[model samples]
Target: MHSILPLLGATSLAGASVLQQALINPTNQVLFGSYDSKPLVSSEALEAQITEKNLRKRAEDLFSIAQEGVEEYNHPTRLTLCHTGHLATINYIYATIAELDDYYEISNQTFDAVVGNVFEYRLVLGDRQPDSVLAMSLTPPTPDKEAVFGPLVLVANDGCNESDFPATIKGAIALIKRGVCGFGDKSALAGKAGAIAAVVYNNENGSVSGTLGTPSKYHVASFGISNEDAQPLIKKLEAGDVIPSSAYMDAIVQKTGTTNIMAQTKGGDQENCVMLGGHSDSVAEGPGINDDGTGSLTLLEVATHLADYKVNNCVRFAWWAGEEEGLLGSDYYVSQLSKEENLKIRLFMDYDMMASPNYAYQVYNATDAANPVGSEELRNLYTNYYEAHGQNWTYIPFDGRSDYDAFIKNGIPGGGIATGAEGVKSENEVAMFGGKAGEWYDHCYHQLCDDLDNLAYDAWVMNTKLVAHSVATYAVSFKGFPKRTDVKMNDVSEPSIYHGPKLIM
Candidate 1:
């Protein structure tokens, strides 16, 4: 219900005039009926509105927002849930939608979220601080005057078990290998064995970084180091060298308030709405232009263009927050909805990382019987659009990896698409998508280099158009769409399958 008056002046008079006409007078009531009357928004027309130029403009805007935070916060990264960059991101999306208030009802849904912040972190071995040290998420912040100092004891196995820590681990910093268990388990086990802190080294190439899952009474401060950085330390330790190490960490995890921006078309069926969303916040590593900036902007661009015509079913867009920390915003939104409100939503679509440099047109495969009934229909909508356009696509699981988790768990049919993230491309995928087979789909998935240059413009545009086509199609009719069923809430005790920084195990 909140509106920003300044945004009204930002709209073009011609576009506003056309919007007025489209909403007040139309020909086809069966296909499209507005609050008043207007022409039905066609798939071709909506798709035509999605352009590379528009996408890049918004991408650049988002990148600058994150960059501004880097300069303001004087930190390596400040775009996550605990940073000012995220606040700015929320404001940006809100303003964009507020500008088109005439066509949509915009609101800010605020909620309390558990967010973490890292002020200072370091791990020094024998007077040398390695560049590969990364502070694990949810690690308890260090006191201002305290820094851990002791022998770096190499734990047996992955340090997932209490017995993995040797007798000498008392008052030491345990060095464990990353695998076999969650980081939280390793750190907790190390603490239980009398270690002050724990450091996990990567099992594979590249630097390791992840959450300890959540704050726990048993967990101690934890850090992740790269494989290369740990090899020499391990060799020296095995040679009976007491490698003196010092660790300093200053961070905190606490409850804070954040907002979810939502916009629904004023013209479509309010009783049977089509919803779509993407997380607006990035990780602490980088600006995350492709990680979700692509998804957020895609929603923005489509919503902007969608204002020009009427629809049969209401279309709603959401810019979710704190997805990297976990699915906080989306989950909060879903939790607040009444049973009637939940049933009002016909289906929900999610878009995340739409433009990986080494991309693939991967649609969410909602074929699992566990998925909500009609979830497959939502999947087919995107596949049909791709197939009609001669675009090659593959299937990815609806494993509750994104914001769709909340909706699907509530028995609302959910589906969407993503390019790829962190997953290595196969030779067959290279044959279809034409990228380096062994390399990550996005080398800069969660790194300092995930800037504007990281996006694949071609892939982004294709996916954006696909989004437009789907939105237009759903908005026009639900002829073949299934009716909402009384589905019981999914088991709450099951572990999360989201690909957020948290370890799945």
Candidate 2:
């Protein structure tokens, strides 16, 4: 009996004997002896060979949170209205939210409450200040626009380069803009520039987020403006328009109102762990049973089922709170992993809206897509399962927009499942699946009606099975499955060569 060191805590004793029996019975001398020499490996060693040691125990804990609806990854909460971001239900991308109130022209009294900014109230060109305040005439239009006002003021230092300020003071505001770096960097720089209330704007325009997506890291109220709006302000600068034009950026916007329910599974070495996650929250208008509930619940059920499976690897089953808000929960988690924790991640498997009338097993960065870091082995395991079960799948590249974004950027392999959402069904898909053409795979995508009624139970079950197999397969599979880093479709899980019904893209 050859001895093998155990890594993932599980051994081949469970079902390994069956494969061994089939191999050594010697009943079919010709077929059984493919191995010329005697097989010296023990069944326990075989089992141990399949177990993965990189998983965390929080899988069960996080899953329970989702099952109880306590950890809504996409909904607003006390922490973020919906853990979408540290901002409010809505926030400025690279800037801060704008606010104002309307008043009766004759009464000269504040009438309407505040709305959004140019970052939030960009839509409102008309003044909404209190009629009383507007009618007062600002004491003959105050000779200096730079006069420090007690109520709403856009304050800043004379220079734009220095970021040296002390926190000893409070109340005064700070003025900032894009350029010297990112939105978050601007906030820190401005804070150092000495101003409690911080207001920032874009340095240039076009699509401010660079083709990749928005950058992570935020500290204070940030605002984003279009080139049209920003350029005009800059033009004013060229013409010495340094006087405060408006006070929209002067208001306060808070995402601290949102809540992020984080459930984790402790492991031997949680410093770095694999994250299997899905969004647990829903859109404000919908219950969201399929757009993501399918994925969330699938992961939840798998975690629950595997609760007692003493995995050697730290396996963390997570439910994000701000997915609908553009992967906020996941992004937060990734950002917070310690440098050591970041390195421990084996891979990140994400399940978002994984069930639909028709399911196609897709991989991130498959055909011509791009992602930060992906696993070929895991990708192969998924595609291989479909092929093994007599299913065909397509490999495609996907923007790392899901919770797995931070992980991938930090060099963690990322992949996920998505039956379909927010897109029209292609003719091939419609013809293959027999669903109505010109319709979205998920008719209830983000609507209030996206409850269990809109779900296809069969599809949900299939996705669950796939996820189950994926998690189980990883927990106990030989070769430790495969990783899907590059778009090597044929490298690990090559399209099945078996003759079977063709699967349409």
Query: Top TM-score: which candidate number?
Result: 1
lDDT of 1 by residue, 441-466 (tens): 99998887899789999999999989
What TM-score do all the candidates reach, one by one? Answer: 0.81, 0.49
lDDT of 2 by residue, 183-213 (tens): 4444445445443333344344432321101
Clash number by candidate, in order: 1, 73
Least well predicted 10-residue stretch by lDDT in candidate 1: 9-18
Best by lDDT: 1
- Model 2, C-alpha of 415: deviation from truth (Å): 0.4
Q: For candidate 1, what is the lDDT?
A: 0.79
- Residue 402 of candidate 2: its Cα lDDT? 63
Please, what is the whole-model Cα lDDT of each candidate in the order they appear? 0.79, 0.41
Supply candidate 2's per-residue lDDT for 72: 44
